[model samples]
Target: MTQDAQKDSSTYWKKSRVELRAAGFDPDRTAKTTAVVTIASAWTNAHRCNNRVRGIADLLVELLAERGGQGLVVGAPAVSDALTQGTPTAGYSLVSRDVVADCFEIGHYAHHGDAMIVISGCDKTGAAALMPLARTNAFGLVLYPGTSSPGKVSFEPWAAKGTNLTIMDYAEGRAAQEAGRISAAELVELERNVMPGSGTCGAMFTANTMSTTAEAIGMMLPRGASHPADYDAASDIHADVRAQARASVEALYRLMEAGIRPRDIMTLRAFENAITTVYAMGGSTNMYLHLLAIARAAEVPLTIERIQEIGERVPLISNLQPHGPYAMTSLHAIGGVPVVMKELLRAGLLHGDVMTVTGRTLAENLAATPTLEEIGKQDIVRPVGQPVAPANNHISVLRGNIAPESCVLKLSGKTLEKGEFRGTARVFDSEADTMKAIRAGEIKPGTVIVVRNVGPVGGPGMPEMVMLTIQLQGRGLGEDVALITDGRFSGVSHGILIGHISPEAARGGPIAAVRDGDTIVIDPGQRTLNVDLSDAEIAKRMAEWRAPDPAGRLRPGSVHDKYVRLVSSAHYGCVV
Candidate 1:
């Protein structure tokens, strides 16, 4: 080893070197003169969405070693909400985010690593990967594993024009099958073809949304959020994904040398830029929770109300997935996320001066990026002047007698046009009961389906009810029925659904006091969610409310119990 490398080598460093040697690494050759880069990922054989990350992590580790740096591969718990839906384990979805973040933090801190590279490809994984880096303000970057290829079926009768099948198609297909709208053979075809390969879901769901937000927040390498996981050797653009990954590994060393940390890039303005992208893309409502959590970790002041305020000024321009008819890859073809960011910048909606992982301001990055017309003609992302939704009120923060602390009304242009919905509350305490009622055809038009006792406190994890919403959509009640919940919804969920109800039911929120036939009003214009009952009457009912026994759901002293004890309200990011 060189004397310069050994100059700062202490007894502790020698001990760490010995441990590295035992792990088959040449510590003297790699670690002695280089920074330690912890390559963290939520990789497992548990699901297709996350399973591909291990390969990316391995490639990064090799790249880091090639650059004379020591790379430590660390794996965190990976959970698939799509696989967990309708199961008891669904509650573990959001819980996994914290666990993954904690796991990576432990690994990174234990090694005293100088830099980090998080490879993630699932709904929660992207945000989970970001939390540790943001909390430590580490010199790092997040690599979205990328969206999967749609099924290669010649016939796509169910798919919208110019769009491909995704996991959501299968989900909605199952709901259609359940409703007898499609034959079993048709559902089987969708099941076989929805997800054809590795990577995250094809839609602009939480995974894609969070990945895009990461780019906008300046946490990801430029154009890194817009690549496909399954690369095509024939296409130079597709092949550049691997090149970008290698480049990002090299950039880490440069970043460490420059003393540019995550906090340097994840500033308040950077976060605002992320929120702007979320609104412009008509991105997932889950962005609200993830952004809130990440902002808290980064020590940047952000709240649901602030997010709402930003949304009010931004417009929804992207037409992709659940509410629209396009895939994430479609945006990729039109020059990726930078196209959307470029358009937003043109409209003066973005913080162009914000720093990014690419060692350039967001404006600098976009200045070199190809525009939609330059790349090719595409309408996947419309211009700011001609937005899909004139107002980005999708994340409408509602406060009234029902949700005093505020809840979220997820809206789209279609739902926004409807203005408001007034209906008799059809209260159900559990998701199962709500699903049962909907499947039984008991849910009627103008019915405000209130699913309570399933919030962060009540669920002890706040499981997403995407399947239930999908069922409602398949049964042709998406617009006809409105569902409000203390629990959350998946990014794939659409319709007149309001979620993340604060001061949740188990804590004796007014939602717990709701009874059948209680009149409820969901007005997006007024930004209010209220029941037609007197405040005194609602308070009286809540006075008699009792929280559910912990043992009745999850075991005492379980992870869920711990989360319940430490987790805050959903509006507060439900951080533990």
Candidate 2:
């Protein structure tokens, strides 16, 4: 070994020996001394999504020991967006991503681990897990605990006769109840069955989107992003995931032996691959923020503008989740993300030469993988030529007087059909007020909902407004109205909406000056969002505009306060 390598090995031995001894292991007798940190969100009743992570971590620790490596489990904080949605507690959700990354970073530093294994299952965990691995440039891989099995539910008269249900269905069920289309007991039944067991949400929301992103970013093993979470080794149907878990452990050793690290795998091209995957697969808007944060951690120059540039060239091919008629499990049943990646590769949309944690190029790993056509005659992942939405037809990055830095608009089928919206503004300062207006049936068609003072610094977390959008769909006015916010929306949120408006209201952006009945236009084809008011009028309004009194929500120097102080604008990925 080189002199520096020898010194590093010696230091690792001394540091690990002490930790092993403290944990009741005889240092000299133990042949394995290399510390391998396994970062996981410990089991919690807050949500089923994270309850599987601890078990995966335990499995990793045992497997690492069998392979002559000393493994240590590190707990990272996690929050459920579904559970916290629309509540003040929602302020803690995005903050948890940065907190989880910090926890993993501290744990790696404390253990002096040369390698890491992160098992993730929540909306934030996937991105949080990757940020530290990239920052540290360690030999590590991310394991998605897999998607939760779709829940079974039946609705009559008001809805379809399907059994598949997800959290999105449950959220919209409440809206159905409010609209008198469904009974409260029907909504209750949906709540009980929407999420049956452990794993991430069953749809193409933030969790599953980021899970796919990890693999495409070259931080996860092949075929690791889409397996069902409840499957066991005894079942023939789940044998692939069992083998995937075992293969990951084996790949870890190979990566270590080759001195390959996450940075070596997560290159600019890899980030581009990830962006292409997100666009092709109908991924969440949250992926934009998460990818930006992770790219910053990896010291990559991945910008929201670059993400839009990639989205412009890649077609939305996957027919899944809030945008389509399928769940993530349907894609898994047919071949998972590799099927989509292979199609992109064939169409020259992906960087197939990027390195991956498997100690091979992405193209090499996918060489033998089956495509959607070969897996079956499934339409879950459409061929690139027969895309769900053409390039630049899905996600539009818009800049206007309202969002000078930029904002994201998720163009759905209905929105694309209409092409443009010019409506009078129906302004609200918070999600709660908007929810109240929606419930009261005060919101009308041809109304552009301008919700400001809820940006990163404004909301102190940039909480998602899924409840509002879902209710609009439930109210039968989804296509007729548009929502604009400096905050964000859930991946499950659809309809004509724009989010992540930078120069947010809290920082005196033009959105703060918007008043009820002002004319606003949203044109996807032109890629612009603008209010009809003059620039001088907007400037005059901003000159007199005052920020809301945050003292009601923010505690001095609390985590939220710190996040508010450090977090950047949404256009920049809202990084701290």
Residue-level lDDT tens digits of model 1 in 1-576: 222332233324435767868878666675354767778988887777777677778788788878877677888888888898777788999998999999998887666666789987788898897898887666799888778776634344465443467788788778888888988988887877666667788877888889988889998887777677774312222354577779888778777777788889998899999998888887787888899999999999998888888888988898888668777887787778898999899889998998888888899989977665576666788878888878745678899887999898887656545677899999998889988999999988889999988888787689898888999988889988899999998888999989999889998788888899999988888889999999899989988988787777777788897888899898799898
Q: By summed lDDT, which 10 consecutive residues of candidate 2 come out lowest?
A: 232-241
Please give the lDDT score for candidate 1: 0.81
Worst 10 residues of 1 by lDDT: 1-10
List TM-scores for all candidates, in order: 0.95, 0.94
Predictions in order: lDDT: 0.81, 0.81
In model 1, which runs have C-alpha deviations exceeding 4 angstroms?
Answer: 1-17, 152-159, 231-240, 373-376, 416-418
What's the count of clashing pairs in each model shown?
A: 0, 0
RMSD of 2: 2.7
